[model samples]
Target: MIAPVENKPEDVPPAVVDEEEAEDGEDGAPETQGAGGEGKKKKKKKKPKKKKLEQTEPPSIGLSRLFSDGNYPEGEIQDYKDDNSYRTTSEEKRYDERRMMEDIDETYNNIRKAAEAHRHARKWARKFIRPGMRMLDIADGIEDAVRTTVEANGLEAGIAFPTGLSLNHCAAHYSPNPGDTLVLGEKDVLKIDIGVHVRGRICDSAFTLSFDPTYDPLLEAVRAATDTGVREAGIDVRLGELAGYIQETMESYEVEVNGKVLPVRPIEHLSGHTIHPYQIHGKKSVLLYKNEDQTKMEEGEYFAIETFGSTGRGKVVEQGEVSHYARRADAPHVPLRLTSAQNLLKSINKNFGTLPWCDGTSSGGGEQLNHLVSQGIVQDYPPLCDVRGAMTAQFEHTILLRPTRKEVVSRGDDY
Candidate 1:
């Protein structure tokens, strides 16, 4: 429930009397420190100057950043804390039952916890993903660690999407299928994409791993491109400018791989996407290269800045392998013949709210999931791979666009 905030003395605005004295005397003229009687002219001694006070935000509650309860009239300040800090009005018990503050606190805290869990998962994956490691084990282990860490912190959590461990020539979305055995080799280029969500606030970020020393330039190109993208993102900034910046950064590096010098190329099809609560890909798309679209980045939104650099051709196409699934539409499902289908559909709605999920954690198994997919209740995500056998690297970060600056919530030490 929305409750009254406690008064904090430190947050209160300081008195402005000293400021007035510094500018002028109490009577609007300079007051002399020496005894100069009535209207007589005298050489006056200057008094100690007072420091200027910092400005404070306006005390209008309805106009405040967080609370906008309509019950309180506009321009009326609800100083429930008595410290001039705007807060939810305490007189309205009905609004208290609505619990906007509590819900906001829960959502904000969950997002932070999710970012922390993702960071820990990436760190763990870095240690576990060595040469000869199985792809299935790495994905399952990292996802398990993320869920376990979030649940241990007193909230329910899950993977925002499938844990992807795409190998060389595969750019993105290549999670291992059940019973499939594929091991990492010494010369493989691995891209690990991870996601974690607490209460549907997702932190989507990724980085690449290369065992062969020759692909270091590819890795550096992707990392530099990601940094350029992050630096150029801002409120009302042109999306194409960011796209050009990232593309220019990646294309600058010419790497020596496979006994030939190849200019690094950005995967042109995959663009960084705007993110929303419970939704991974939102409205806006940031391109890998400059485009004719002039979409401007808006404030008060979150975006996932993902960049893909390749040592081969920049173009990527979908493979026949399809394993991940998310709901195609939000409409009510038509009645199915099998009881397992109905149960699995209900479980998906309950467990994975609008986010994409894999059958990895499903109890109904792949057979039932495939039945649902066939019925158009869900959609599949196939792996995107480069056609020219190029080793690819990717780096991504989740950002919140603010008025003056942006906040990167998925940052780690390695980034």
Candidate 2:
């Protein structure tokens, strides 16, 4: 069972650890000291206790020892394999399942509509986005643009996934803090993740851009890796097979970001997840590694294919000390005060659909206040980070793994 999100008022964020520098042997084991002379004695140091929000440093081990030379290591890929699974069918049977005619037409129209909205919002981001803008400022602009574009197209503005704006080493879940007023630098690695839902169908996608011209190749590799994942989102594909494809292809590119070869290790804990109506990270997972759970790819299922690349190492550490309350899809229903709070928000969202709100200053504030006034059960406000250094890059696309084919909900000519 999933643990309830706890509310710890006194909790403090731990120091960030960079696992890229960890020392390991070629066999993926921590290296021991060389044999000493008969009279020599080996020394060991005590390990510090890990704090809840302690920051971890990069690993000391070289890529050669973790992964074989000329390739990236696969030490931590097992999580994906373990958490996800699929059925192995005969080759002939796998190829016979295709989308029905009605499904294909539905998918085509959804993709086209989603692509146009995405392009409009992306162009707005490209125009108002710059190095000097604060992260929230950019997010505000993108959100507004997305809502405006979708409404103009006669579409609903449902979020495909939570918008993420992680900067260097902070790969995901790095949004601006309340009252934060900071400026961006030329070296910042800006990763923008956004979504659009039209008429109950969703299209979620992401893009990563930077100020450094030299980092163009890194972006290109990320783009290619995302493409490869989407292209392989076909019926009956093995979970591990897709991950291996990404691992092998990106390693082959040897692109550098922030002075290090792109890390082969994805945020192993997080993989692309299923997207059904009103649900993100739904029941199905399109794992990047092999696993026992081969969730048979069914026709008409929508999925978000996301991938992250790093410069220091493939290993990702949680640098930000932020957390938010999310309702678990599989959790048992509870009779708690949260329902009232949820309803208040739900009503506002129902009306706004695709409209933008400034959280505190909007007329939506009336609706939000009514819930809070009732003393509804609200969890603690999660922490936020203001870290410097490190960079993050990502790409994503929403897709329908059709029975015999695949359709990209967020496909664009430029993609």
Candidate 3:
């Protein structure tokens, strides 16, 4: 069962050792060390207890460890009413924040390297993505590039999410299967989503590549939408307000298909997400179009602003093509009838705590994944496609929201 979140964390008690604890052979009896090498019965010595100091003045002086360098979100998420997980305790606040600030510059440097690795991988895709390239092979090559680049920095690094190479009408969530034989065509609209996490700090971003020049308007619309979000995002700005500007900017672009002109629109169903340690989709979501989301942007928070501009209607619907799986937030502990299901569940929890992954990347078969899905332990992200035969294009960036300005970590030539 999940524990309830506490408003204020309780103070941790100092470590104390019990002197009456038993040894391997003894049953709840105290043992003492003597001068003789062999075990011999010896009388215990009782030492005088130390007196505790009694003082009452101020709560400072010795409270530096608990009082300084806290990264607790100020003016954001003051409570856990909307949060899905446990509250960040005082202990975690002190340790995570102090350590993060001590290495804040190094953290930024590593994250930049990881973001560059992701960009390098995407750049490689632009030239290598041809008419007859298999989707599975493309995914492998892209992931290989990310892994190689990150490892060269001499720090722990890896891909944050499965390489998603959604094509044409498929907007996102289309990682290829191990034996997938789907090949690209000359007119395919490819979205390359790659992520890299160095020591758990991640950069989640993507860019769309179109072989046909006719879809350039759609690509331009998404890029404009993403840029508007970044421009409007601030420490005190509301998320809905930022989303409104992005939607307004996207609607200004028009696409010319055949002999008719249609106004390009952002997909309402998809929105940009915030990222946190090992967790891709974190706190708030920035919508492509304006709605009624009152989530406020806070200082020190990270967000990945993304937009999907479609040539058809601005709504993406699931088309039963699921290729990625993420462990549900409320993961149920239930027994499965098949042994394969049991093994897959163990592997999922061990390898990926809550991160999204592909079934082909796991050590189990399709049948094992199906069993877990039946039990509601896994959420399969289906391919979001346009209702009409509209081309889908996307642009994204991972950014850090500071008190004064925003830090774009994954900004590349595509932006």
Q: After superposing candidate 1 on the true structure, give the runs of residues whose Cα lies further than 4 Å from its correct spot.
A: 1-106, 152-155, 329-338, 365-367
lDDT of 3 by residue, 1-415 (tens): 1355644322423243244532412433345455776554444466787553321121111211322342211211222222312324446544655565568456655566667666667766676778888888888888877776555332246777788888888888999977788998888899988988776778888888887899888888888888778767766677887888998999999988898998898888999988877678876888887887888877578889888888888788898567888878677887788988888888887776677888777778578898788889888888898965788888888887643335687876556
lDDT, candidate 1, 44-145, per-residue tens:
456886653321221111111222231111111111212211223334433543453256546544565677667767777787778977888888778777
What TM-scores do the predictions have?
Answer: 0.72, 0.62, 0.73
Cα lDDT listed for each candidate: 0.73, 0.55, 0.73
In candidate 3, which residue ranges exceed 4 Å CA deviation? 1-100, 103-106, 152-156, 335-337
Runs of candidate 2 with Cα error greater than 4 angstroms are 1-111, 152-156, 255-264, 290-293, 317-326, 337-389
Stronger candidate by lDDT (1 vs 2): 1
Q: What is the lDDT of residue 110 in candidate 3?
A: 57
Error of 3 at 293 (Å): 1.5
Residue pairs whose backbone atoms clash in candidate 1: none
> Which of the predicted structures, 1 or 2, would earn the higher TM-score when compared with the native?
1
